[model samples]
Target: MIKLTKLAVLCSLIALPTQALARDVNDLGVDVQAATSAYIVKNTNPRYPGSYNGSRLEGWALMSYVVDTQGKAKDIEVIMASDTRGSEENAEKYLTNLEFAPATKEGKTVEGGYLFSFEVGKYFNGYSNDKASRGFINEYDEINKLLQAKEFKKAELALAELYKDHTKNTSEQALFAWLKSQYYYHQQQWFGFDEQLSVAYLLRAKLPTDIQYLVAKSALQWYSFKGDFNLAYNAIYALDNIEGKEFSEENKLATIKQIDDLLARTPQINSQINVSKDKLSYLSLSRGSIKIEGASDVSKLQIRCADQVVDLEASELVNYVIDEQSRRCGLLVKSANPAEIKVKQTGYAIVNSKFDAS
Candidate 1:
């Protein structure tokens, strides 16, 4: 799940009412989606050893970045590492040479911050026996490279090959799903939305509870890519519901509140939907306060727009949509002390358009 601060939401609110923030270093970009993308590139790419002539081995780096008002990354910390010895040192060395444009709001850079963790380098697993698996994994490595290089087609092809042949184990399946999700996200493609959702579900369902937080985070990414706001919410809920006996109560509450606040303030508004386009576009209403309760695993919620109600299963993210128009739909939700809704189904519920407000 994404961690947000009261100050961030407050900044988002102030930016919305007084003036529409330009896509500057302060506003954090659309739905915080673009912010995540930009942050991943900033933190991860530096971990890989630049090529001198030999192919680079693939691996993932888990690092946290503190993005300041200038949209520049500062004080990056390594939470975990997949790099061999000295990779962290090398990453730090590379990061020092980097600069970023801080996030801006209302034409001025606000001192807001965001953190991100991403895998860097090629995802190489030392040794394997099956040639098909090896080829597929290599292709997967190539796909990661394409992502790193901003190459989509070749990476997509490589992903297709992996999904088609080598994903039999849980880890392999997880890798395939993550790669596919990232690919579609980069191209703004939704061709495999449902498939990716299913893949995320399958992966999460099989993971142990201890690791559910990580799974929930990954599921949130899948839901966001698939444009399933409800699913994304449910994913956060799942994260919130975890027994935090091992953590301080203050930290647990803080974590849950951050997730809740994000959902409450950031409304996913449909800006454009074309039946022929195969993808959905939305303008995040990321500036209001729509209060929502923290969930406990399998909570249910219903969403209403216009006059229709759609049922969705709540976890951290819920998946629901309005399909009356099928092709195009304009949506908005009023957060002026909205009413609590009940969900009938186990996924997301789409409400009627009349329920939407500007």
Candidate 2:
């Protein structure tokens, strides 16, 4: 695997916001979603390696990056790829020479991020489309129109309804995630935007490439900020046994290093969740374990992942350690009295980090 000597993701965005930031879009009274988006000004694909000039082996690489005010690409992530031999390295090298037309907001150049996907000798045009149901499509169109009309309240109601019923298929879920994320973005509600964006990220393979880009770009910020290295990487590696799924992380070296850096810079989480009989408390972890500070005060604890849940009896003290398998997982603390729960990163996350770039 080829490695960058040093990498700082998304320019200076590594220190992710905990949703209480002042530098977010809300500081500027402008509609970010309606603002002009960035575009490539100079995109020259890297030359095929001479060693594989006539070889049958080929691959593709997809990167997620931001265009700074000066139109320079920074904080790049090798978000997806195919078996593209050494094409992943070439894609990283291409960043030095690539440029973009900076996006404009409120008549001034502003920073925005996007995707760049390329393929080599082997073109997998069979990359299939994962479509939503007709009912979902119609409702999606209506919700989009409402958002465009700036009917925020109606759009929120529609999104709530859609969320309740979008579970019929992965594609429908992805579409709903993308739409709701855009809704929060327009209002500069960063907290809601990234939280819902993380949903689209989990079902990334079901989303179109463009939607994947938007989801990934925002994910780099939200997940990294929360110190959820395991969950963040797991979301990007969400490809299942689905046939015709084009994106593969066979070349995870680049993205792994990027996430490592983001996670390293994100402040460690040593927080508490107080639970009561009347309400259940939820705690999201980036990488760490959970312990009940006063187990005697708790009645039940639900250790939750994206798809599974493990219930623990809280009659005694409880300590649950998190590892690579604990992905996109959270904890639901239940207590008859007010119980103090502590969550912190015990060690860095490592599941399949030993990837071969060759």
Candidate 3:
């Protein structure tokens, strides 16, 4: 069977309009200004099975047909299908009954190909009696049961087999990783737990919206517990990007508060500094003159401001006087301990360069 990548499918869909009313086929092309100008007055979606061996299966199918001069679809064929058990057949049957406005070229009816894509998932309610889908669902249920029963060892074994069986399914892979993370947490295997949870977190986008939030929240908890503030901060950042009705209003407020609390506990960099791509850190002195102190040896320190580069030796306090007209200053510290560099503007602000430690 020929397999079409998602990119290829998208490109084909995009190119359909141009080919639908090719100038060569008809001099005036379709009477409609756009290929999609002809509208479908009546349409029906394919019916999906309620249960595929006691479990719901979801996927997509692509069908193509020609809208004849009579505004009726004919010669429907399935071009591709994620699952062919009944998706292709159902889609073809539905397309045949679909009615569209007749496409006209030069004021006369003309035939044009139409592509229809069907998504079979939660939207359709039915049961599939397919053997492979049923087998996969059963295995998933068995492992979930073991996990719920606290049979960690057995669940681990079952999960391994499940992974081996469905390596091609990204959603299933993420679910397995999440389950393994839970198993490790229950077993007090902290490192293993974090590792597995990290895998699941990175694969969160492949999961559903609700699952994405759950995985991100779990990651935030684990990172916070481990005192890895940087990773925790990142997890909070990821959570902020996820927005959906699945998350309640109260929950959203609580999440915002959690982010604020985390940020408050995080250390700040002294002096407002902007790090450039060239590896030079810049401090804007438009606010006021700032004093910098090196915690470690700073004999090779270089400071550049107003296009003037100055080499300074290690000292208890290095004062750089900035003219009111000077808006920016740059610092390049070369020391065994980069974390020792500190900057302060007396009575104004104290900024710590935690990024130097990273």
Using TM-score as the measure, which candidate wins?
2
Off by over 4 Å in 2: 1-130, 160-170, 188-195, 238-252, 271-296, 301-332, 336-342, 346-352, 355-358
The TM-score between candidate 2 and the true structure equals 0.44
lDDT (Cα, tens digit) per residue for candidate 1, span 1-358: 1111110010111111111111112222223432221222233232333442332322222233344554455544442333234445544544444455553344454333322222223223574211224655687777888998997777767776666566543445445665676677677665453344334443343234555455566665655553444445445445555564144557545544554554444344332211111111112222121222322232223332211223344443334444332111112121222222222122222321111110
* Global lDDT of each candidate: 0.37, 0.51, 0.47
In model 1, how large is the Cα lDDT of residue 203?
A: 39
Task: Sort the candidates on TM-score, descending order.
Answer: 2, 3, 1
Sorting all predicted structures by lDDT, with the top scorer first, yields 2, 3, 1
Clashes of 2: 5
Q: Work out the TM-score per prediction.
A: 0.33, 0.44, 0.37
True-structure RMSD, every candidate: 19.7, 20.1, 20.4
Q: Could you tell which candidate, 1 or 3, scores higher by lDDT?
A: 3
lDDT of 3: 0.47
Model 2, 163-273: lDDT tens per residue? 656434446656776898889988989656754565465445557766675566566556555555544554444322224545555544466677767766654566555
